[model samples]
Target: MVSISRRTFVTATVAALAAPARGARAQEGSPRAGGRLSFVIQPEPTTLVCFNTTEGPAIQASTKVVEGLLTYDFELNPKPQLATAWSVSEDGLQYRFELRRNVKWHDGQPFRAADVVYSIGLLKSAHPRGRTTFANLLEAGAVDEHTVVLKLSKPAPYLLYALAAGESPIVPRHIYDGKGDPLQNPNNRAPIGTGPFVFKEWVLGNYVGYVRNPNYWDSPKPYLDALLVRVIPDGAARAVAFETGELDLGGSTPVSPLDLERFRSLPHLGQETRGYEYSPTLYGLEFNLDHPILKSPQVRKAIAHAVDPAVVLNVAWYGLGERTVSIVSPTLKRFYNAKVPTYSYDPKAAAKLLDEAGFPLRGRWRFALTHDFQPFGENFKRSGEALKSALAAVGIDVTVRGQDFPSYLKRVYTDRDYDFTFHPFTNMFDPTVGLQRFFTSDNYRKGVAFTNASHYSNPEVDQLFAQIAVESDATRRRALIDRFQEVVADELPVLPLMLSKPVTVYNRRVVGHTIDSAGVQGNFAEVWLRG
Candidate 1:
C-alpha cells in the first residue's frame, strides 16, 4: 500500500510477462480432467460486500457464480454471452442490444432486461467500487422487455468491450430483492450463476467449491463435476502444494525461480510445469497530481524520466517482465502508441528538470508509500530509495510510505489520502474505457470516470478523451488517443511507466489453461485435468 488508499487498491496490476521468444518452438494444447482445482482464494474477500467493495479475488471467484452480458476473447473482441447481438446508432449516441432468450438465474428465475437494469442500478446505488465502470452504459434506457437501448451524452467506441468485463457482471434482482444486504448474506456463500458452474458451498477460509450447472446455457463448459478451490497464500507453499499432490492448481501464486527450477527438475519438463501470462495486468507508480508539489509538470516528467523500468524487469523480476512504455500491452497493438517516449536511466536529466523548475537545490518534496504483498513490493522499495537519493541530489525529497492493500484502498480512493501509490490497473479489452474512466472529473473519488487522484484535468484533454470514446474509426481513434496522451504527458496527470507481465504458476495436471492478460477469467470452462 502507498499513501493513496488504506483499504484496498481495488485494482490488481498482476499481468503480462516477457513473451517467449518470437520463434520459440510451439507446444500442443493439453486438457486435463477431474481431480479438483485447488488453490488460494484470499480470505479477505469472502463476503459479497467485501469483494464488491475491493473487487478482489473473492468476487472473482464468484465469476463462476454470475455471468457477464458479454465475454471478450484473447483479442479483446466481444464474445457471445447473455446478449446475442447489439447495435450502435449512426450518430454514436444510441445503442440497442438483443438479449439472449431463455436464460435463467441460479434460482431458476427468467432473466430479462429488468435484471440487467436492476444489477446496474445496484452497482451504482450500493456497490462501493466499479460505479464508473458502467457509467457510459448506464446512460442508456432499455427499449423493451428484451432490448436495452443506451443513449450516450457522447460517442463511445469501446462500450461493447467494457460490458464484457466481470466488473459489469449481471445479478438477478429477484433473488437479491429482499435478501437483506446484497453482500455478506448467506446467499453469497451459496450464490448462483448462469455460467458453467454454480456455487455449492464454502468451507470458511479453507475452500469455496462449485459444481457444474446441469442446466447451463453454455455447451461443454465447466468440464469437471466439481471445482475445488483451496486457500493457500504463500507463493512457495502453493507451488509446493502442487508438486506434492496437495493442490491441483496455483491461483494467485507467483512462479518464482525456485518453483520453476523445481518444476524443471521434476519428471516432466513441458508437461508438468507451465508458465505464461494469465491476464493483462500493469504495475507502476500511480501518482497523485492532487498534491501541489507533484502537480508540477516538470516534477512529474522528471520522475517519469528518472524511472528505470528495465531495472524492475531485469533485476526485481528475474527477467520475467517487459520494459514497456505503452499502458496498453503490445497484444493490444491497435491501441498501443509506439511513439510514447521510453523512460531510461536518466537521474541526471531528472535532476535537471527539478532545477529547471526552480527547485534548484535538489529534491523539492517527499511522498510516503504503503506496502502490499505484491511480488513487486521489494522492487518498488528499491526503486523508490534510489529515486529519493537521486531527487535529493537535485533538490527534491521523496518519502516512501508503505501500507497494506486493504488500508491503501480505503485511504486513496475513499479518503483521497495518498500522495503516490504504487499499484496496477486491471486490464480490460477496451483501453478507451480504462483511459477515459480514470481521466474524467466525474470519476474522481469514485468510479472509472472520476477525476484524477492527482486532482488534475484539462479541457483539451477532456475533449479529446470524449471524442476518442465515440470515434469508431480505428485510425481516427488512435490519432485522438495520441493527442490525449501528449496532453497528459505535458500536464503529467499520470506518469506512464511500464507494461506489466502476469507471472503465473500451475500444476502439471492442469491443462488447456492460458491466463488472459488481465489474469481475470479463471476460464474454468475450458480447463480440464490431465493424466
Candidate 2:
C-alpha cells in the first residue's frame, strides 16, 4: 500500500506535470555528487533574515541561501533567477533586468546591476510585504554593470508575480551598505547569498548549517555537499526525526495528521503533498482589531458564526482541509471569490450574533478572548483547541496562547498583540499577492511588519484596495476582486478558516526535490543524493 499521489497546482497542464521543464528533476540514474542534506525547520528562524521576515521559517531558511530576480517555475511561471533576462513596458510602466553574469556574493562579491538596484531599494524600503510588494516603484537604477531598470508608477501586472516571490531576495550592495537598520543587519545573521547554499552556520536552538556554493552560479548544480537546517519544534519531534533515519528533509508541515498514517508505513519514507500548487494557503482566525472585544462588526460576526469550518476541517485537519469561505483559495482560479459570505454552521446563528452584539450571558461568560497558538502546526495547537471548543459552545471564553516562532512574530507582527490568532495566510497567488495587504489602511503601521494584522481599517477596504492595485482590466480586475471579497465578507476582519495543503516528507535517499506552489520556496537547486 504505497500510493500517496496528491500534488496539485492545477492547469498549465497541471503545472507541466509539476516540476521539470526547466528546474530539472527527471532522475533515474547518473548525476551523482557528494551528500549531506538533513532538513527540518519548524519554528526556529527568528532571523536568517529572508528580507526581514514574513517568516515561513525565514523564507524557507532563505530559499537555499537567497538569490531572486525571478524564480517560481512549478508553473507559478517566471523563471530566471538573478535576472538572466526580463522585459516589460508597453505601458506596464517599464522594467528591464538582464543581469546574471559572473555572479558571486556568497562574499566573493561581484553580482551587480548594483545588486539589483539594491534589492529593489531593500524591497521597497524594508520588507514586510515591502510596501505592498514594491508598490509601483517609480525608480530603480543601474542599467549598466549588467543592466537593471524599473520606473513604475502605475500599471503593474502583478510585477513578475512579485519578482517570482521568495519575496525578492537579491541582496548585498556591499553587505547592505553601512548597515545600520537593514533590519538590524549583521548580514541578517551571517547571510551573504547568491544561492545554492553558503551562509554556513546558525546554531540558535540547534541547527542551520549550509555549505556547497563552490561558486554556485549553476556550475555543476547544487548537488548537495552540506545543508543541515534541523530545528525540529516538536510535531512529535518531527515525526521522530522522520522515522529515525534522522531526516533528509521534512520542510513544510512535517507529518502530523496523526503522523500521517504512521508515515504511510515507512519503507524508507517519501511522501509529498505536491509542492503547494502555487500557494493557496488560508487556515484561519485572525481578529485583533485592537481587540476591545474584537471591535464589533457584531462581534466579528459573532466569531464568524462561532467556529465550525467543518469542525475546523474534521477535528483540526485530520480530514486534511478545504472549507474556506474566501481569503481567496479555490485553488486561485483567477482571483477566487466564489460568492463570499458563507459563515454557516450556526451555533444558533452564534447565539443570535452575540445577542445582537451587546453580548448578554453575564456569568456564563460573554467574552474572555486570548487565543494566539501559531507555533506552526500541531494544527496550530489543534486549531487553538478547536477554537476553544467552538468558542465554548457560543458563550466565548478562549484564552489559548502557545507562542514561539519569535513570540508568534512578536505578538502578531511587532506588538499589535493579539486577542485571537491561529495563522497561515501565505502568498495567495494574487488579489495583489494575497488579498490586498490584509485590507489596507496603509497596512496598519504600528511597528509595521505589516499584513495588516487586523487593525483592519475600511474606507470601503481602503477604496477597494486602491482599485485592486491598478486594475488592468481583467474584467475590471474581476470586479475589484469581487468587491474586495464582498467587503471582507461583510467585515469579519479575519475568519475564513481552512484551505491548506502544504505537506512535504522526503527520504527515499532523496533526489531532485522541487515542490512548488512556493511554500518555503521549494527548489533545492535540483536536489540530489540517491546513492
Candidate 3:
C-alpha cells in the first residue's frame, strides 16, 4: 500500500513512511519510571482475552497483561517473551521452545510449560485465527517444566510469525483448565498472565486500569507506575483530551483523519506511521451469501458495480486509504496479486445486471437491503452511509444500521441477519493466517466472530489455500497464492474498497511507544515516559 516491495516491506517500510514525522524522536531525556501512561481504546472491548475473538480493542488491552510464547522485533523476527529460546527441526515438523523460568501468573501461580500446551490447545479450538494458524499442529507436549515441543502433522510456512501476543496469547492453565467454556470464562473480562502489567479493574463504558507488575520476569521495564485504557466513544472528546494533555497515547488513527494535521501542529504531539506492519489492514464490504436475494452471482456483481472504492477512500477514509480491488491487502507484497478482476463503478451496468437477475425496478426501487458497519471506529459508519447513497442511485433502497461491537458480531456471524456489512480486517503477516479464514470452506463457523461470515465456499479456492499452507518453495507458493486470489476475485464474496495506512498519535512526553511492529497491540514493557 505504501509502495513497499518484498525487499523492504515488513520493518523497512517504517523508514520509508517516516519522512513526515521526523520529530517523533525529538524528545530525548532519561526515561522516567513512575508516571501513569494513559491511552485510548474506542468502543470498549467485549472481553480482554485474545484467545477467543480477534476483536481489535480486546487485543490492545489484553496484550498488556497477557503474553504469548514469543514477541517480534521491529524487523518482524521472533524474540523471546515467555519462551527464552526456540528451535525448529530440519524437516520443519517439530518446534521446540525453551520456556523462561521463575515467571508467575498475576494470581501468584507458577507459569509452567503445561500452560503453553493448554493454551495452544484452547487457541486451536477457540481463536478465530488460531483455528487456521495451528491447524497443522499435532500436539503441544511438555518435555519438562520449562520445555514445550510443538509437533505438527505438516510444515506450516508462517507458523513462527503467527505467535505474537495479540494473535495467539498464552492464558493461564490453572484459571482456564476446567473452566466452563473458555469463551464464557469470567477470567476473560479479568485475565491472568505473566506479562509486565497486572490487570487492576475494568469499569464498563469507562476505562480499564492496569498497574505495573513488580514481580514481572522482565524486571524494571514497563516503567509506568500505572496504565489507563480510557474508553471515550466520542471522537471530538478524544481530540480535546489529547490537545489538553489529558490523554498521552492513541493508535490506529484514534481521532478523525481531519484532526490528524491539527494534532501534528501541536508541538507537544507527534504522529507515527510505523509499528503497524504487524497488523496491516484492509477495509471493504462483506456480503452474506446465504441471503436468497444475494445467492445469485449476477446480483452480487450488480451490487459491486453500484459501489465506488474512490468514494469510500475519500469520504470515509479522508484520503488516508489506498484503493484496492483484491481481497488480499497490497501491503503484503509477496502474495498480493494485482492482476485480479476488478469492479468498476457503472450505474447503468448495475441496473442492467439487476434487471437480468429478475429484480426489475418497481416504481423506481428494485430492492431493499440493510447495511451494517463495523462499530470499532467512525470511518466504517461513514463508509456505510456512502454505500447507501451509491446503491440508491441504482434503484436499491438501503437502510444503514448502527450497533455496538458485541451486538454487531452476534448479528452478522451468529444470527446472519444482514444483507451485507462494511468493515475492516487485519491481513496479518501472511495470507494463510489472515486471508484464508475469510474464504476457506472449513473456516465458515457460524458462531465465530471473524471467520467466514460470507459463507463463501469454492472447492478450488479451498484446495489452493491448502496447498499454499504447506508449500515452502517461494516460486511455487506465489503461483498458488495467485490462483487463490484470482478465483476469490471472480466469486465476488466481498468487494474490496481500500487499504489503510493507519497512524498512531501520541504525546511528546511518551517515549518508546513505536519500538516494535505490533504498535499499541504490543506489550508496553519498553514504553516509558520522558518526564
Candidate 4:
C-alpha cells in the first residue's frame, strides 16, 4: 500500500480535488459528393446549458453551425477555424487569437473577436474546466473587432485543449439575450453559426435540418445540399435505418464487437462503422462516500477486489474494454501512475477486507445502485448482480435501480441525489476537463443537494494540484501528477475499474473517415461523400 502516496485519500473522492489543471491526432482526406450518409446514435444531448451541459452530441450538431477560434485537423491537431492564426504573450499570461477575415455569423453579421469575447464571458466562474482553462487569462479582452486577447492570471498548461471543448464553441452574443436561463435561449432552437450549414428548421421530436450555406466562406465544400439529424433512440431502429440508407451518417448506438464481423460481413454497411479515436474516457461505479458502510478504505478495496473487470470485458462489454489500473486510461497514459494496484478477482480477499472493516457479513449492509435504462446501458448490470451474490456471501445487502438517462443524469450528476450509480463517462481530449468534472465540488450527481460525494478534502493534495496546474515545465508537472495518483490509491477514492474497447460501425458507401483517441474527432473537414 506504500505505492499509495498515502495522502489524505484524493483528499476527496475526486469531485473536488485540485487538478493538474487540465489539459491531438490528425486524419486527412479529400471532399467527395453525391451521397447521403447517416448513422444511428443514442439520443443523448439536446441543449447547450453552457455551465451545466452534460453531453457532446448537441454540441457536435451545433459545431457544424457554430465555428470556433481553433479547430481540429484529422489527427486532432489544433488548426485555425474562425481564428486563422494566433500568438501567445512572452509571460504566458495572455493569448491573442486573430479571426479569419471575411467570416460571418449564420445570421450574416460579420464574425468578430467581440463575439468571441462575449461568448467566453458566459462561462461561470464556478465552471471548473472553463475556469481552469482560462485560468491564465482570468478573462478576455477585445484588442480590436477581429483580434481578441486572453489574459491569464497564471501560466495554465492545459488551456488550449480546454478551449478546444465547450470553452471555445463561439455562441451568438445577441442570442444569449441576457436571460437568467441561457439554455432556454431562442438560439438553441434554431441557433445561428458561421459554418458550412445554416439554421434551416428544427422539428422537435423528429429531426433538426440545416441547409447548405450559400455564403459559406469556402465554396465547393459541404457538398451536401442539406443536412438532417433525426432523433431515434432505439439502437436497432437506428441501425436498420443506416443499413437501408436513410442517413449519410450515424452518430449513436455503438456497433457491438461481436456483431462487428457479422454486420460488416453484410453488404453496404462496413464503411459506416467508425468512432472517435480512443481518448481518456472511463466508466465505473461511483461510491457514495457519504454511505456510512462504504466510508472505510477496506470496504472500497473489498468492492474493487470482488468485482471482476475481466469478466466485464469478456461478457457485458464483449471483451471490448481495457482494464484500468488508476483512473487514467492509456489514452491518458502520462497521468497514469502504473504503481497503483491493478484490478484483480479475489472474492475471498474481498470478504476478508469487509470483515476486517467491521461488516459482519456480505449481506450486512443494504445499499442502492442506479442508472438510466437502455438495455443494460450501464454495461455492469449483470456484473453488478454477480457482485451482489459475492457480497451476500459476506453479508452485504444491495439493490439496483433503473431510470431514464435524462432523469438519471439530472438526479445523479446535476442534482447529486444519488447513493451510488453506474456512471459511464465519454472520453475527452483533455485530461483536466474530463477528470475535473468528476472531482470538482461545483459538479453534483442526482437531483438532491450537492456535496463533494467523496467527502474527501485535503489541504496538502489541493495545494499540490494548484502547483501542478500552473507549473509550465513538463517534468515538474508530471512529477506532481504521479503524486496525485498515489494520493488517490491511498484514499481508494473512486475505485478505478475497467476501460471499454470502442466499437464503431459504418456503411461502405462512406469514405475518408479517421478516428482519433479523443473518441470521435478527426477529419470532419476532409470527410467527403464517396458513394
Clashes of each: 75, 2, 0, 77
Candidate 4 residue spans exceeding 4 A from truth: 1-30, 48-52, 73-76, 124-129, 165-167, 174-182, 255-261, 271-279, 360-380, 393-395, 404-419, 425-427, 440-451, 515-523
TM-score of 3: 0.84
lDDT of each: 0.59, 0.75, 0.84, 0.58
TM, every model: 0.79, 0.36, 0.84, 0.82
Compared with the true structure, what per-residue lDDT tens digits does model 4 show for residues 149-212?
8877887766655554333577767666476567667776677877777767766767767777
Encode model 3's per-residue lDDT on 246-314: one tens digit a residue: 999998888988899788779999998888877788887788999888888888899889998888889
Query: Candidate 2: global Cα-lDDT?
Result: 0.75
Per-residue lDDT of candidate 1, residues 1-531 (tens digit): 101121322211112212222122134343434556664554435553222544556655776677776655445545456776666666656666777788877678888887777776676666544444455554545677788776666655666565533556677777777778776566666776677777777777577777877777655556677877677656667666767777655444344555665676765322221222223556566667767667677877777776676665565554545665655555565666667655566778887786777666523443333322222446666555554554555455567665665665666766766667556654345555455556666456542222355565677877886677667676888898877656665565665555555444566566555533324344467666665
Q: Rank all candidate structures by their TM-score, best first, as comma-separated numbers.
A: 3, 4, 1, 2
lDDT of 4 at 57: 61
- Per-residue error for 189 in candidate 4, Å, reads 1.2
Candidate 2: C-alpha RMSD after superposition: 19.2
lDDT for 363 in candidate 4 is 43
For model 2, where is the 10-residue window of minimal lDDT? 1-10
**Highest TM-score, which number?**
3
**Per-residue accuracy of model 2 over 1-531 as CA lDDT, tens digit each:** 111111421112222223343334443565678889888877788777577566677778887887777666445666566776666655567767777789888778788898788888888877766777677888998968988888888976676677753677777888878767788878788888888888777889889898899888887978888888888766787788788888877756676777877788889887776667665678777788887778888887878877778887888788776787888887777677878777777888888888887888888889788888866557678888988998888889988888677777777878777787877776456777676766788767566444778888878878877877876666888888888887788887888788887677888888767545564465486778888
